[model samples]
Target: MNAGPISATAAATRAAARQLLRIVIVGHVDHGKSTLVGRLFHDTGSLPDGKFEAIRKMCERRGMPFEWAFLMDAMQAERDQGITIDTAQIWFKTEKRDYTIIDAPGHKEFLKNMITGAAQSDAAVLVIDATEGVQEQSRRHGYLLHLLGVRQIAVAVNKMDAVGYREDVFTKIEAEYRDYLASIGVTPTFVVPVSAREGDNIATRSQAMEWYDGPTVVGALDSFQLPATSVDRPLRFPIQDVYKFDDRRILAGRIESGRLHVGDELMFSPSNNTARVKSIEVWPEPSDSDARPNTVGAGQCIGITLDDQLFVERGEMASHTTNPPVETEVFRAKLFWLGRKPLEKGKIYKMKIGTGEAQVTVQEIEHVLDTTDLSSSTTSKVERNQVGEVVLRSRRMLALDEHTRNGRTGRFVLIDGYDIAGGGIISMEGYADQRQLVTQRAKNITRVQHGVPTDERERQNGHKGGVLWFTGLSGAGKSTLATKLERALFDRGYQTYVLDGDNIRFGLNANLGFSPEERAENIRRVGEVAALFSRAGLLTITAFISPYQSDRERARKAAGEHFHEVYIKADLGTCEERDPKGLYAKARTGEIKDFTGISAPYEAPDTAELIIDTSNLSIDQALEELLGYVEKTFRS
Candidate 1:
């Protein structure tokens, strides 16, 4: 019996799927990249019928040489210009694996398009013209490939025919390029010499290069390894959209890392919301033989309905509670700037990563790097196409991981107006803390006390000592109430001290500014001083517009159980009217930066022990009420 004729579609479907590898070809312009890709497709028998003949006929009509590059120059503009202006991806297959070849443009003006191509690739073939040796864009593309985290690379010293296929020419260019790649930590799998135009040593070994012995281009590609699956790592599913189809609200997105199973509880970060997976929904339902239909691994896109209708948006990432990503606003990152304009401090840009977008500012430029030689220079601005280390501060907190730990959540791109201005990887997470340094330094120092015990001092003072931390708007009467209470306690023959905001800034916190990190440090120092006074058996009263809740929590931890948060209640309108020093007017006109209650944020205490509405009450009445409570709590 004879088999019937099979259609092209049927043959393709019947063929078993091979291990997939996405490969990108990059180098300087006119380096025969397209010719190499065309040759690979033709020699591997991956081209369809009449495709090669069509390109050859077109070349003849145009009175041009029969070159394989014409096969890839499918676009009319590219065929006429003889240069790839955009990225072109074509799928081909070898016996061992299926490959997606991404031909990235080498022109300097089209580097952004090249980045888009390289970012999706698992490996790369960096082609260099043997006659040209090494060019400017060759080094740059190499650097970018390393930055994109494409570790598997193979160097193709192309256009070997132009150099007369000399063994020394191949050896010289190979040695120089290899040394440069090593400097940037890229180890090429193989360095092969080939004539892309002549189809020599692409799919099969070439006899023209008798002196050289290495894997052919096809063999080199097969040797490149695929990235390991991240399913064993913690789950990081960034929700793209909430879809409601046929009576179910399904959260839809590709699982970026780790595995997701039915009945597993997940905590969404930055928002800190929890939900349980009800079922893994697929487009085409799986068969009964498919084990665990409610489970999915990394790289799979699926929709899932939760047991609880938890409010989750596109930006919130679903992470396992056991190991969740860090939630922070200020982080240190290493990035390359491709914006036409230089990246300057204080200028805001939009950052987008995974499923989240937020306004971001370059808080500080630590250093600029010379990408060619890996040299560092102290600079305040990152110029066009320059790599730099900077501290990026976002308007809102984001759940992010270190690039080394999870590449999906760690990589981000900066948008300047309409275009993607830059891209980066998170290096470190968290803001600067000089106080932490001081704490680490104090570890070796010994404890010392000069006078009577705290109990004896409190007994003699006729009160139990504690700290009263007054937090509110700048002109909300926190300072006025603290001063009045201090005098009232002193008149009653009790030990008391006031740490006024402006008074302490004049000396102790003189060097600190009003930035978020600086404000935290200022509060940290004041909290320590107030704690020391409390230990000395004196009631310590702190009056400051401590805005952030995190900073206040630090103060509470420092002052122990005796610490009391007193929120002096007053709206922004009332506080601005009572601005005695005319600071509100100055802040409104942009004369003062990071001014709480005017420009910056002022987070009111959520669970304050005391709430005093100073707007309605007179100073004397407010003080009398506060005094009564303090005396009752501390009376001996």
Candidate 2:
């Protein structure tokens, strides 16, 4: 059993190298992520000869005429702007071990970058300037990291040299920051005090701080362990893309499960596609069984080229042979509504889950959460940057996994009109049952129709009949324009029927009114009716103060290209003046509540092909332009 004794430093380095830690360094500008890294290289002798000089020459070429803070920043934007924009991964090693450091930006506008960094990290080393203590962005990053389930955290009290290497100062700052972290359910695992500028305690203990007796920045970082990955849970490799080389087709993916090997049976989910693992191609060489699974798991950058290319696409995920994934029609989610407009219930927005996208509506805002405090609010509407718990009702349910268990299938983003409005993880699941409920509830509703039939309707009319959905405030003259349009179209031999809210309430939609839910249902029913009539090829003109954008979008989906939208745009004051039904008058007097033109909210569409201002467009002119657009729409 006699063996050669290894040196203590060698033993420590081996132990550190074995620990697979994924670290993200996050801090405000000038707080020193790059500087700390720079110091780490210098003190540990990682910097080769002429490397410092190389960076110095680069700085000189850029004409900074001073020491460069962006040498280690790496990114061109980071080098030029002197700020990290997103989380960039860099590998470094000390005599004690290796570290995967993710450098993240601090700018408020770059929250997406921060999200990406936090999402990929196991533990975070938050750099806090000793002079500033904790600021708003610091709090925000901390909160987001906590939400992301980053358990272990390290707080580097940097720039201590500027304050005379004050131990008492750092102690006070640490206590204050810890209390705030506690409020958000996070307790940092380690706090290392160092001056990234002076190189004190970064790689070496500061002789300046005899009062301080704790781990150096290098020791603290070396000690931190990579958070345990969820390999035992389930395999979830999101298919980045499939590749074809000659005759071989490889479904490229990263392993998010128990070790996958050659000839292993695997199944692709959501698509319900399956394929066998011909070989897992990881280069420069595939992982051997002798290596632990932690070395290769979710979030690790490796590609798996399967035996056969099975139509795998980005956003799709692969699972194991036995435990298959479930598909559903609806699911509960915690959404961060980052859209400019408030999230409207029963409005269909495109939801992007992994690679799969579907039309979904906020079925119910169970409760909106206060972003600043993370507390529940009774308010039904959630605005920009507000994170809330929402129950979404989708047109079609996609397969999903609980976010806590799986990151791949669990996360999704919402697209409003053309922009990505929001994104978040799947906090809850089981939407198929809700789909059944929604379908069952719709069965009791009876149908109503306008006189003209399909082929006869379109043949008699020059073009197919469709609803030109016009939405604006009550005074916006939706009905007036609709009536004018009907008269003109009729004169032109187009068999058209104008469906106004006043007339519909008198007949079909009389049961509903201005409450958010009621208004949504009314619009939904009308949108459906209009689509049906248009499909039959008749010119169906419908006008209402359908203030919700989601409702309008749903109407478009229901009608397809046959769906014509007209936003009767007008000023609130002009609309108030033109109030035909005296609805706005009554709302202003507070006699009527939850009114569309008064108390209720309106989400204007980001992209509307036609925008008509009734204040400027006389009934004659508005009708002329609208009919013109509609005439061309069908022809196109």
Candidate 3:
């Protein structure tokens, strides 16, 4: 028997089956992203036989010079237009490991395609023309890479031959771009000067520039470390479907991370259902008597039967009891919009994360980012091809992880009328994981009804007892209004009290801190206390910067009909200028963490019973309106 020679594509595929790293090359249009990729394959002898010759012969017949970029721009339209309009993927190898280089388009109109490539890459190569230096698209691509959480980067200063291979030219571009990246919290691993078209300093060092001494482009790529394997991370098996074979109910899904074993305890998230894995099931059972497997790791598709008949369904994630995904109804996302129409607040869109899909509403657009200059401005909507920080709300809780923690379950896409309009990475920065809060731990509890009637208490006090919950930024004057209103009610022969945020923290909520979880717990405890005070025939006023809308909703649920939300409205500028306690200054200077209207978010009420704009009205005028409303509504 004779063994046949393997084809280049087959050989590359076999090599790719081993350890591989994904790298996406991006830059401004005509900056040579595709050219660098093509030169890399040619220099490394990674191209198939006759592939280069065919391209060169075609260019000769067409009366055009042979272009290195033609090796990557395979599409006829791209070659005709002299620009890459889509992402192109190819496989090559270095002595160290196999590589999948993604050539993403550099044209501004094709940014969505660029984002698609960058999202799937483990690292990135940013190309810039040595003669042109940095351009608008260069900064935009750099910012997008950082937004997608690609930290390992190498900047390739291509077209160095056009600039005569001057070391000073490369240094100037390096310093300027490095500072820009650092401002956005990214540090490139290396910046190498190369002329991809001339094949200088790509695979080998450039001999033309004797003043420069640094690693070649290949060296920079080889230096990037591979990300930690998924198997070593926590388990996250999203239930894709359920199959009933004979009498066994099998839960089917792929192991996105970690490992699972037979008899291990599993907890399904967003539902909080628990059961033990009865058996690890696989098709075509092992023929050998002792060949049955009992465990599975990341990237394997398998099914398992649970000991108990739990009502598990698709969209629920299975994980070990110790480390589960965060369960929440609202979360923050850094999203890139690609829809022709802008993404507006209060509009509902379908979100797909892992195997789960849910309808999510755009709660707020934090800010629309200017990728070219890295400046952020408040906007009502996110325009096409723009990146923005957004808050999304779902009616039901969803199981997910922050992108920084686990990339597999942390990313999602938005579908609008059957089109992928946007995509983003999840972040729970200013929100709490509501798993513990939603779980009712008490085994036996009963409500005790009050003996006294509310009408009798109101007759005795000459007014109805209720809670006036004032919510706003810290310097919006919630505390001042609450204290003054309490005094006015007392002088008018009404039983009244004020629960200031600072005063409550000193005693009742002494154990609570300013963390998202602690802040939620603090609001929960105060809501219950304020409700009790209302039931006792005293007008209770609460002054707290309850920044989260969900937290305020919980408080409203606690008080029911006796609650009246009062919104103290003031712009961020006005509050900062007032700076009663100088807290905003401290927050800007990094002295305070998670400070509302500064480092943290402040969710204003959309259904407040009364809205007082403190910026426009004096304290006396605002108080008069507040007093009139209370007197007209609460007087018996």
Question: In TM-score terms, which candidate is top?
Answer: 3
Whole-model Cα lDDT per candidate? 0.84, 0.71, 0.90
Candidates 1 and 3 compared by lDDT, better number:
3
Where is model 1 poorest over a 10-residue stretch in terms of lDDT? 433-442
lDDT of 2 by residue, 1-636 (tens): 111123545544553546546688887777887788777766776654566777778878878754435546666777777777766665556765566667787766777677777777778888899988877767766777776677788888898988888889999988977887898789988788888878888888889887878788778887777555566667667676767666667666565554555566777656666677655555455366434222355544456656665677775767775765545555667766768788877677898866567788776676776534557786668877566677775665466777776665677888888988877777543222221212333346776775756666555656766678888887787888888888877787776787788777777878876555567667778888888777777688888888766568778898988787788898888978877778788888899886764565555556777899888878778878887886677532
Candidate 1 lDDT, 1-636, residue by residue in tens: 111123645434533345768899998999999999999989888887778898888788989888788777778999888899998876677888777788999987888888889888889999999999988788888888888788899999999999899999999999998998899888888999999888788999988998988989999999888777678778999988998878889899989999999999998867777788988888675675354376888878888888998888898899887888866776778887989899987789999989999999887787887776778887778998788888787877788888778877889999998989889888653343322312333346787975788778878889988899999998899998999999999999989999988899999999988776677788989998898888888899999988766677778888798799999989899989989889999999999987887666666786998889998989998998899889888778
What TM-score fits each model?
0.69, 0.57, 0.89
Better by lDDT, candidate 3 or 2: 3
lDDT of 3 by residue, 1-636 (tens): 111134666644664466678899999999998889888998988787778899999999999999999988888898999999998888777877778788999887888899999998999999999989999889989998998999999999999999988889999999999999998999999999999989999998889876768789999998999999889999999999999989989999999999999889999998998899988877676677366568888977888899999999998999999999999999999999998889999999999999999999999998899988888999889998889899999988999999999999999999999889999999999898878766767868998888999999999999999999999998899999999998988999888999999999999999999988899889988998999999888889999999988888888888988899999989999999999999999999999999887778788898999998999999999999999999998899
Error of 2 at 609 (Å): 35
Off by over 4 Å in 3: 1-17, 53-65, 75-81, 282-292, 449-465, 487-497, 535-538, 571-582, 615-624, 631-636
Candidate 1 runs further than 4 Å off = 1-16, 230-232, 244-247, 284-292, 429-636
lDDT, model 1: 0.84
Q: Identify the runs in model 2 with alpha carbons over 4 angstroms from their true place.
A: 1-20, 58-65, 75-80, 229-233, 238-254, 261-268, 271-316, 335-344, 366-376, 417-419, 429-636
Q: What does the lDDT come to for candidate 3?
A: 0.90
The most accurate candidate by lDDT is 3
